[model samples]
Target chain A: MAKGEEAAKQLPKVLVLRPPPMFKMFEKEFSEKFQFLKAWESPIPTDQFLAAEASSIEAMLTSGSRPVTADILCHLPSVRIIVTSSIGVYHIDLQECRRRGIAVAAGGDVVSEDVADTAVALLIDVMRRISASDGYVRGALWPIKGEYPLGSKASNCDILVICCALTDQTHHMINKQVLAALGKEGVILNIARGSIIDEKELVRCLVQGEIAGAGLDVFENEPEVPREFFAMDNVVLSPHRAVSTEESSRAKFELISGNLEAFFSNKPFLSRVNIDE
Target chain B: MAKGEEAAKQLPKVLVLRPPPMFKMFEKEFSEKFQFLKAWESPIPTDQFLAAEASSIEAMLTSGSRPVTADILCHLPSVRIIVTSSIGVYHIDLQECRRRGIAVAAGGDVVSEDVADTAVALLIDVMRRISASDGYVRGALWPIKGEYPLGSKASNCDILVICCALTDQTHHMINKQVLAALGKEGVILNIARGSIIDEKELVRCLVQGEIAGAGLDVFENEPEVPREFFAMDNVVLSPHRAVSTEESSRAKFELISGNLEAFFSNKPFLSRVNIDE
Candidate 1:
């Protein structure tokens, strides 16, 4: 056996879960170098799969879709590292990972600019009705009736943005710096994420019509949205899909691959999440 | 009277009609210096309002909302010039103005970049489904039922822009240079005005799906869009409303003001459509 193979066999088999295209690319790169690389299909139930694979697995790769659970961590006594390919670890039970002395790594800052660009694009599209108009044209509906009663004009309008307040970094990511840049020509709509914005202030602005329109992608509640938001025609809401870009996927995969590589080498992982443990 | 007032009084009265906010600003400016300035309501029909007013008018200030017709030019024997505050003279009969020796001036290139920015924003929104998601969230619907399916992200997707074929300058404005910049990450979708693009070639690219998606604001026949265009979901269409920004209205007013000032003094107008006239 090659020195790398023997070394990997002596350690633990690393199981990288299905990631976006970027993840796959990174996995391919790691697999070429590492002997014990196994990638699992996505949407695997944590309990069932972790129970079967935990004993032999030393490291596991995952994303937002396949969150690591406390129960699953309990089964994987040999697992020393948990790597997520995304910045947000809300899905991963970090406390449990810490208790088990598993290192964690995630993708961050690498994809922020791309996500911000997408957010701006999304805001402009919603304001201009670009997609609906495109839908009409593709359907052969020329002179798209009711499409341009007022027409798609941006210079006369204001814009609002609502985001989550989870951390100082996320706050700075979507705060006055970004908002002010966007607000030079339009109004801003930031509803607190406690770490990102203040809710009461945002509501006051919305209720008073301080902005011409708003673009919202996050909320305090996971699955619930405010009822008052429905009456406004100027607002646009997104269910927090802005950062879920292909670029993010690739960045995430790289994080996962790097974590697995570090764990087997008994070196500190790059994105170590539970450092205390 | 001041020299400006003396000149304005000697010239026959001109009625300049526009919407409220813009009209208010222009009226205030004109009323202070010119005795001939008469501001009227917008959306004035061709035959009754514009033609009737044209009889006594030496000049007419109009906007995109009203079409300055050949018949009106014919009726306005004293009319020396037709000044519009808009870049597009599509509503005015340029051929008639030239034939009748009626000078015409318009606003151009003042806000092309702004419009381009808006166009790109719309394209991103449609492709990413930003508005649809917004609607879902505002409606108190969480976990947006029809989320954008995970696939190739915008960075990976090709973009197409269908536009017109105008002057070499305008040609340059939306040419391969601009396309290369925007398409650095995607593709170009130009298919509206022959003045902006080559139709047959663009259609071929669309058919082949060389570009993953397109944003078409203008058409070859205009008002008579092709049937085949309706078949694609990846395409976004704007019924040629790309330039209808709030700034366009103000830009039009300034263009008209310059033309009017030039006509009364026999000085050369800034955007004189025909020097021969």
Candidate 2:
């Protein structure tokens, strides 16, 4: 037998629905342990590819961006386990996984410290205008304009930080009334999912100078942030990257590899998602 | 006596060379307790003003921006106390103050919390490129440019934070060798004085990409930062505003008032600087 075929036959199969962010960089290292059946590399439609590999495939790996819906799962009859390199499993149909008796594992608390650090960074960024003042200095305005205007004393302390999971109950939790109570001097920071805030109301509040400012990582319709925020200096915008760090990425790779190894060896899984809920 | 005279007679006399920042906001409130001898408001020269008011002025109030040279002190023989609304008293002649036996008061630990907050804010801003990403989003680059390139992941660890006071022994303490030691991935944050780091060597290091980046609040010269820093997105520049928050300003005002009141009442000074060194 050819060496490639021999290696493929000996290694356990793991289907990759889509590559996660920074996945390509670690592909060679991962290929040694598990033969990743890449659906994206196939010319056939995803459903056709899944149907062709139905009998052979028993587990899959996916990213946060791809949806693992019921329709997508229907093609993979023999699949028993799925692993995603993301903390949020909102894209995965938990009910469908539960119905099929399929197990799931996700990124664990590796990102918690980085996310907390981001929260403070964003909070201070919005409240103290650190980002804005940096711009002012970079724009060469300091020489002409003298001292940058005073920023709100954030350490004087009136702040709201959002880090809750996105759920039906949590949608639009930070609405107008809560914002009103937070008042004109208050600042808000969101490292959680964007839909948790009423973005429209937030835009209106910012436009009318009701709330002080915001530092946001995620948005309701991401990659399409509210254009109004572009002109405002008080607000600091991030491209949904609060949890992304080199250290966290390394930890995630370890966890994903560990979970896959445990599943193959019939051991207890690390970071298994309880799909019954 | 007239009503104004009656009030002035009961109030304590204090001399002001130039007003502290935000002085106008609290001028009326301050005037109620102390009779301020405004030298800047005089038509005569500052020396003439000081010469004229030498006997009546027992205490002088100054800001961080203005200098209190030995020449100025020569004209204020009766001035027993100097109260400055600033954390750093480098502008005041400490040796002169000591020789004349005049006690000096400054804006002490009031700004410590705010300054520390700024240190973290700048650190994350540079490491995560929060400000740069905000600018990219604002410039409408997200859709066209795809994802903003990944920042160095400041939470990935390596960092240097400079928060020590600048003294004769500490000037240019963070020179080329230190920057070299910090190396390619290390980011440096300076919330201390500008002269503590060799600005020329820093510019060379940054331009050559020897070190990762910097977050600077103070500069080598007041109102004059090295022009090279303006172009580097890795650097976060602040116009010496780490201590200018409103809450700290209020604290500073209270401290200044307390110090002046104590000096007049023959009581212990608050935040008195031991200028013997």
Candidate 3:
């Protein structure tokens, strides 16, 4: 037999839907353990390609951005496992997985520390006007405008940080009354999904001074943040990168490999999601 | 005897050069404990006011902005104690204080926590492009500009934080060599005095991309940051407010009062400066 045929026969058949960018860093290791069927790279349409060739695939690796809907799952009858390199598995149809008894594994707690750190950093930046003053200085406005205005004391001692997944139950979690209870002196720090909060209400509150300020790393429509948020000095914005630190990425890689290894060897998965509920 | 005269006789005379804003927060306690000779509030010239009225004042309370010069000290021969409501004593003449055997008290470690927090916040903001991206979104540029260029990973691990007082020996400590050692991925966080760094060399290095980025709270010139810094996205600027938190201000007030009470009662000061060194 040919060497390629021998290798394929020996390895587990795994489907990869829209491979993540970090996959390149671990491509060699993954390829050695499983023969991957790249659905996105196939010349035929993804649905047709999966229906024809991926029916025999027993395991799949994916990311948060790709949706593993019921329609796609219907084509792969032999698929028993779905492993995601993300903290949130909102993209995967959990109900369908639970019904089919398909095990779902996620990167859990790998991003908690980095996300918490970013939340605090954003809170400080918003309260102290660190980013605004930096912008003022960088814009050459400081030399002409004299001293920047004093920022509100960030340490009135209480702050709420929201870092949760966007599910039907969690969508629009932060509404007007929650913002009102926080008061004009309060600040909001969001490092979670944008859809978790009502974005329009948040904008209105900030504009009307119902809430003091905000530090956001996520938005309702990412890569398309509200235009109104751009004009306020009380807001500090980042490009949805609370978990982009190199250290966390490396940890994620190790976790993903470990989960895959555990699944193939018939051992319990490292970070398997409890879908029994 | 008159009630005013009785109160004056009972309270120890404390010479206050300039009342800080925080003094208002503790005015009642301060007035009850000591008879303050307010120099700034005096209609008479400061030199005449000091020589005539405050000569016999055994204790002096001042802030960082007030200069406790050799000339000021020469006017008040009977003054045995100098207590400043600040962490740094750069405005005071240490050599003259040593020669005269006068005890100098300062706010020590009261602000250390707050300053350290600010330093970390600024570092994260600069490295992650928090402020720059905030500006981009606010300027209505994000929609037109598409994507913000990715910032450098900034987490090569080691971070150098400078929170030292700028004295003759420590002035301009971070020169070109130090910046070079830090390399392109290194970030400098300064919540201390700006004079501690050679501002000109820092500007050159930042402009030439010699160092990754910087977060500066203090500047070489007060209220006048370098114009060049205003144009850079890699730098995060704060208006010398590393110790401006409300909690820290209260702590500073308590420390000042404790030091003064300790000195008056013939106990060692809580945060006495070592003049002999």
Candidate 4:
């Protein structure tokens, strides 16, 4: 065999259930370190693809949207570790991982600063009506309709910014009472998870003018937002892109590589999940 | 005369060309300190109104929208000070103020922090496509479009924020060469005067894809935006509201009152402009 092919054969193998977003950009660099068995690229069924390399593959990679279920775990008997390119591990079956003694590395503080920035952006966007007024100007209404109504003054705003982990206690923490307290002059900004706020109540509050406005990056059922939000100029909606930044993406790629390298060297995983919890 | 009427007659008289926006909110508080000679409220023409008060009015209040031209100053021969509720003193002729030895109290550092906050909001809004994507979601395009395009990463943006005073030398400072230097990946944000940038070249560059985008608050002319900009999703246009906030307005009011009080008391103006320059 040629030198490059021989060198590739000697590298450790990693099974990819599905390629992470922009995986092609990191493909060459990833290939230099380890061989990735791209399950999606193969024309075969996913289970059969898993079954073919079930005995040989010792590590796997996944993203936030892909679920690492118990059934998938059962198929990969030799898989000792799972690496994800997201801050949240809700998609992973931690109980099954613990039972199998498999280690899981997560996307941790790599996105912390980016998320904070998004929160600030959302807060300012909602309070200043940045998006709404931009729309007014684009709609060619500035000359005809005159000044867009003044938004809540930034220095005088009673604003709430939600930033917390999605836990049993934290879920649905911002409900009707919270909305009522926010009253007619307050704005809420959420770059955190959607379930943290009661969406139905939020809609009701907005519709009735209980609360002034909101900036939401995540929803209870993402890609399935309540249609009521569609007509509200006071609300700024994002496609769950709080952490979707190029720097964070590159940082995640580096972290995943580091985790795999540590696993191969028999060192402790960086940002390893405590499955016992 | 009644004691209250006599007391009001004894207070310092200040001429207001037109009641500033939201003047009613401040009227009661302002009346207690100064007796205002409101030009607009009078049935007479503006020059006639000014002529009537020319001999007695020693102080004048103006907003950014109102011009304190040489002709207006000529009509108000006894005016010793001009107080404006805006950061820019461009509406008042500095040379005329200098020639007449009349002090000009410009809106100073009170609005500095608010303007900075606005610049940040505009920067993040444009770079993240916050307003554009918000429009998509509000238009019910999110469900149909699958995903909004990823905006330029906040952490990897080549952004230029313009924050300088407008001057004869500084006019059209951001020209075609500067735009070319900024190149196709650059984004420009201007919260300063619109004339500081060559708006025509900016339009051409944006049309030809020579530069990435722009976020503009101030325009070359008041309330007259380039019509071509209405169609571009890459641009974010604000209606010259960078320093607008309830706090800033309050601060401006207090400063204006203080300046008038200082003029009558033989004290230094709180925010006196060195018009001799």
lDDT by residue for model 1 (B188-230), tens = 5443353465445445555765445556677655656666556
User: B1-277 in candidate 3: lDDT tens per residue?
Assistant: 9997799779988999888656777788788888889899999999999988987889999987688999999999998889998788888999999999888998799877778778878877776677877777767566676556544344563467898887888889999898889887778888888889889988999999888788898888866788888788888888777776667777888888888888889898899988777
DockQ of each: 0.38, 0.60, 0.34, 0.55
What does the lDDT come to for candidate 2?
Answer: 0.86
Error of 2 at B250 (Å): 0.6
* lDDT by residue (tens digit), candidate 1, A79-98: 77767666666667877877
Tell me which of candidates 2 and 4 scores higher on TM-score. Answer: 2
Could you give the candidate ranking by lDDT, starting with the highest? Answer: 2, 4, 3, 1
What is the C-alpha local distance difference test score of each model?
Answer: 0.58, 0.86, 0.82, 0.84
lDDT of 2 by residue, B1-277 (tens): 8998898878998999999986776898799889989988999999988888755588999998899999998898898999998877888888888888989998889989889989989998888888887887788777778666666566455799988877777899999999999998889999988889999999999999999899999888867888898878899999888987788777878888899989888999989998887
Candidate 4, A98-198: lDDT as tens digits: 98899999887898877877788888878777887788777778778876665555556588988786767878999999989988988999887899999
Give the winner by DockQ.
2
DockQ of model 2 vs. true complex: 0.60
Better of 1 and 3 by DockQ: 1
Predicted candidate 2 versus true structure: per-residue lDDT over A1-277, tens digit per residue? 9998798788888999888875775777788889888898999999988888755688899987788999989988888999998888888988899999999999889888778878888888887888888888888788888877777676554688988888778999999999888888778899988999999999999999998899999898877899999889889998888877777777788888889989999999999987777
User: TM-score of every model?
Assistant: 0.68, 0.92, 0.78, 0.90
Docking class of 2: medium
